[model samples]
Target: MNRRGFLIGLAAVPVITGAGVSVAASRYTPDYEPLLARLLALQGKTLQSSGSWNPSQIFQHLAQSVQGSLEGFPEHKAAWFSHTVGPLALQVFKAAGAMQHPLDQPIPGMAALDPALSVDYALGHLVATLQNFNEATGLQPHFAYGNLSKADYLAAHQLHIEQHLSQISVVA
Candidate 1:
């Protein structure tokens, strides 16, 4: 009711939201099977794309992200963003069990997508890249999200794929 009370309430918002994010991210279980299963399901489907990127280009982009963790991304956000905003965003994504970002945006500093990349080839590359990520020992810090535990990275990757999946569908 009072201006002071209103200000106090507003200031409490982040504290409350932060607590919720912390709890949600902690309780969220990381599952890699769905990622693999979804890819496997795409094995023989005719997919129609509704996004700027083709089915192959989409897969290529996803593969590049996974590879970036293993090899290294060419560039990254400033340390401030990578350490602060990036992690905060990731917490929200983990808390919500999804990622919301520009669907067509390529990973910064990466090569452009190859129109010549076939759907099947890109699909296989993603599958293999994911496997390599799983087997790799050290993960490079994410370009934006900074260093993530393998679990968080896997969860992030899975959510990223889930988000992209929304842009395409199997054509019967």
Candidate 2:
């Protein structure tokens, strides 16, 4: 192959590989069952965090988000923002089947997290929160995105967890 052809072929590799990964990731729906299973598998494991928050903090943060979906968010973006930019952002993330956001930022208006909380406690809260979310028939409005259907919330939660999980490394 000529240099141009070879370069074009090489460029396709990542695109193809990424498409395959996205398909596989989407196959496992990000809902309570799969999330619970993942959490259970990690029970009692030691983990190191690559992000600002430790594993415990991550778990608590996730739990808080899940809980917030059921009970209304403590704070919300302006209606115009939620109606415009927020929903657009959510749709983009949903289309990609992934979410990206600042990791260090906390939910607006929520109380400060207790950094000293044990991983086990945090995990328990996460699991329980997921379960509660699954059983809930009605959902409250999201802080930024405003209103979301049950399916949308599940996907968002899954993407959020997946993003956070990327920062976690099991400590041997």
TM-score on alpha carbons, each prediction? 0.91, 0.81
**Per-residue lDDT of candidate 1, residues 79-141 (tens digit):** 999998999999999999889999999999999999677888898899999989888889999
Report the lDDT tens digits of candidate 2 across residue range 1-172.
Answer: 9999999999999778656655554464556677779888888999889989999899989988999999989899999998877866766676677889998789998878788999889988898899899899999999998898888789889889888988988888
What is candidate 2's local distance difference test score?
0.85
* Cα lDDT for residue 10, candidate 2: 100
Candidate 2 residue spans exceeding 4 A from truth: 1-29
Clashes of each: 0, 0
Per-candidate Cα RMSD to the true structure, in Å, reads 2.0, 7.6
After best superposition, candidate 1 residue 31: deviation in angstroms? 0.9
Checking candidate 2 for backbone clashes, the offending pairs are none
lDDT of each: 0.91, 0.85
Best by lDDT: 1
Where model 1 places Cα greater than 4 Å from the true spot, the runs are: 1-12
